[model samples]
Target: MRTAICDMLGIELPLLAFSHCRDVVAAVTNAGGFGVLGAVTHTPEQLEHELAWIDEQVGGKPYGVDIIVPEKYEGQGEALSLDDLAARIPPEHHAFVDRLLREHGIDTTDRAELAGRGMNISDRIGERLLDVVFRHPVKLVANALGVPPRYMIDRARAEGVSVAALVGAKEHALRQVEAGVDILVAQGTEAGGHCGEVTTMVLVPEVVEAVKDVREVPVLAAGGIVTGRQMAAAIALGAAGAWTGSVWLTTEEAETAPYTVRKMVAATSRDTVRSRGRTGKPSRQLASAWTRAWDGPDSPGTLPLPLQSLVSEPALRHLDTLAEKGDRGAQELATYWVGQGVGLMNRVRPAKDVVYEIAEDFAEAAERLTGAIGD
Candidate 1:
């Protein structure tokens, strides 16, 4: 449908797909839906190459970028490099993770070798990413965790790109609008990745009313929104559009781990849990041994932000590698970020097809609503 987001972003539909796969992003954009690439883990060099590749594929079609810039995290403001952040990770946390893996039948002998740079949530990396973003034909940029930084907002403004931010609470939405965010994605606990406790059904309307007097900004409903009918429902809740992620994880073009994708396809809405085991912040993911161990009695507990990733990424990466090789223990521990809508995503489809399906569903739902009204 023609909503404010469609007009603002020069797209035919107000559907914004948040995906890490460049293929999915380009496909969605070409299908008349906006695609926002998640770059929290990408280096500047990597993001530049991705945006360049998307530029070639979309042929001037508008797309967006998502970066994590949490307001608070371990070693935040201390000029900590990735190495520094890793060093800050307590030995107890490392030992706990190793023991947890060992208990699950995973070999932890090469634990050091499995280490990888986790998410780039610091200003140092974010500033560099912004430089790469402006260097491409990116249409919008969003801070996945908190308010967009001054440099990010300024650079986007100078380049005429719209700025968006994801918020879980009404207060956060108000703060984002006051910070000059062009759009607000009211993400609820049902969403993947880091999220708050509110449900989307309640959060969207709360956010819409909270920011109405502060400024005129389109609110996009996110969390458990995987179909066109859900987008129509979001619009009914005062959202100008819908911001979706989990549904695309099952798409043919997705970068989700093979085993995890299979798990997602078979998962029910109740199978997901908001566990802080991965990111040190409550993020919705499939309930697995990894999450359970972290919440167990013998756990060292999760660390803050980037530091927690240090504890999780290496082990999770190892689990994924082994799970693909048919290790039962690894498979049981392997989980990925996904929303409760995994229940509705039963099949893998092409990204373009998914976009069109959503559009058609939205139309049918809208028409049904129109006909229901007593004329």
Candidate 2:
């Protein structure tokens, strides 16, 4: 609780809950832990609206915003239209998606209409979102993938907002430190969403040790850390706090689709897999018929970031709709981003209760450790 991250963020607990739901964000912050809104899904206007709503809800509690500005994507430098990117998606990929849907008894007739409607995750959009974020009283701004852009870092510094970067490897951690990130989220493969191959147990200490000489930025251990016991373990491994996502998905205030939330509550850690089927980057998600279809031997390989998203998001969105309507096939195919820690998330509780539980459990874990040392 006395970690540097707590002091820097002005939070009582170092548990940072990342969620797309503003309710969860405000609830966690009011519960004494920091809440960071996942802003990748929001456009500038949407982000502004959400932040305003969060500001009113939290009543002056400090919160953070996370945006995805990946280090690499299909359109890294050159400007490309959504039509251009959609055109580049191989016909085979489309056929595979169409076939996958039809086989599941879901209609794919309006697939094209749904393809590019989702939020575009690019530097251009990120900058616009950042513009909106800087005008607000955000305590932290984090880049979910790759290094935070120099402009973002500089702008956050100028705004007196701390910048954080999520990294899966020690090398990436060092690069972020060199890039002047104020906080490092050492995310392991067990994490949901885009993640690298290393496990948290190994990657956390490796990153902490590797970044010791480069800079002393606060390291938050992420990936499959859903409880205070896990948070205590992360601290034992040299993390200042725990950066959690999956556990929040099951919280009462979470905006996770109802069907998906049911699936998550029923899932075990082994029920998740790391597949590039969703975001075109290796991210741990609930292992479902959808992921299995993409991982099968007959499947076409995945495309990169935005391209992969274009193909998958629309289809998944439709599947979710059908699943909600009680389509068994859609239910089997319904999956969402979640980590291996989902097994422990067996029930839905209020977001505030979750924070208090983590704090209480973390205190007990610390006491047990002290007892072990004969203190």
lDDT per residue, candidate 1, 138-191, as tens digits?
Answer: 899988678877888888898999999999999999888888999999998899
lDDT, model 2: 0.90
Q: Could you tell me every candidate's TM-score relative to the true structure?
A: 0.98, 0.97
Worst 10 residues of 2 by lDDT: 111-120
Clashes of each: 0, 0
- In candidate 2, list every pair of residues with a backbone clash: none
Q: On residues 280-305, what C-alpha lDDT tens digit does candidate 2 reach at each position? A: 88888999999999989978999988
**Of the candidates shown, which would achieve the greatest lDDT relative to the real structure?**
1
Q: Model 1 TM-score?
A: 0.98
Regions more than 4 Å wrong, model 1: none
Supply candidate 2's per-residue lDDT for 248. 93
| Each model's lDDT | 0.91, 0.90
